[model samples]
Target: QQQVKQSPQSLIVQKGGISIINCAYENTAFDYFPWYQQFPGKGPALLIAIRPDVSEKKEGRFTISFNKSAKQFSLHIMDSQPGDSATYFCAASMRGGNTPLVFGKGTRLSVIA
Candidate 1:
């Protein structure tokens, strides 16, 4: 079974719009949540992250909203641009452990100029 669930297998957005991606985790022990963005032919890079202790976190145009009680999380892209088009994955892992992160089925976003 997939540990994390994501929606909107694919998405297309106009320039300067908002792009949203959502995810949910099955493991309550997961305290660390991270979002990764990947471009074709390149490794995924960390975009933003949050912990159960926080409700939300934002870095520039990228934002992460975490809900511990709901066991869910989401990524929001503000002022979506063509350059922001990429595959985004929501991941979760336990805090203070060597365990690998569990990633959601990625959401593919395309921004039209």
Candidate 2:
């Protein structure tokens, strides 16, 4: 069962444009939200993250905006570049729960010149 749902299974963005991916979760117990970026043949890396207590967080060109009441969150890639192309997965995990991290079905992003 998919606990998290992600939209725009695939996205194409021009270089220097903004690329956005969104996800929604049904589990309120999820307190930690993280966005992971995975390049071909590589493991997913922590791109950026935000907790329910915070509304947003930014790191370099990556940013995560979260809405606790809405049980939704999004990742925004500013000034997207061709090198930024990858498969992104939004995940959540309850700090106290024994469950492993739950992830959305991954979004494939391609940035063109």
Candidate 3:
């Protein structure tokens, strides 16, 4: 089974709407939870991240809500835009700066104008 389960393989939202992506992990040892955004023909870029101690984190129009007890995390994009349409991924990793992350299947979001 996948380490991280992501919901809604794809999504379509009108411009200025909110885009939400959810993920759940089965491993409690995972301490780093991050969300990545990727545009076509480019590598995934780190959008936002949260640790187990943090319940929520926000950067610009992006936000991450984490539930340590539930081992789940979600990403919300405020005011979705056409330029924001891309593939979003949720990832989990141990407490290592040079470690690779176990990523979710990914959610493709399309912001329609």
lDDT of each: 0.90, 0.91, 0.92
The full ranking of all candidates by TM-score, starting with the best, is 3, 1, 2
Q: What is the C-alpha RMSD of each candidate to the true structure, in Å?
A: 1.2, 1.6, 1.2
lDDT of 2 by residue, 1-113 (tens): 34999988999999999999999998888888889999999999988878899999999999999998888999999999999999999999987756578899999999999
Which one is best on lDDT? 3
Clashes of 3: 0
What are the TM-scores, per candidate, against the unseen true structure?
0.95, 0.94, 0.95
Cα lDDT tens digits, model 3, 1-112, are 3399998899999999999999999988789988998999999999998999989999999999999888889999999999999999999998768678999999999999
**TM-score (C-alpha, index-matched) for candidate 3:** 0.95
**CA displacement after TM-score superposition, residue 9 of candidate 1 (Å):** 0.9
Clash pairs, candidate 2, are none
Error of 1 at 103 (Å): 0.8
Compute the lDDT of residue 72 as modeled in candidate 3. Answer: 87
Rank order (by lDDT, best first): 3, 2, 1
lDDT of 1 by residue, 3-87 (tens): 9999889999999999999999888888888899999999989998898999999999888888888888899999999999999
- The TM-score obtained by model 2 is 0.94
Indicate the worst ten consecutive residues by lDDT in candidate 1: 90-99
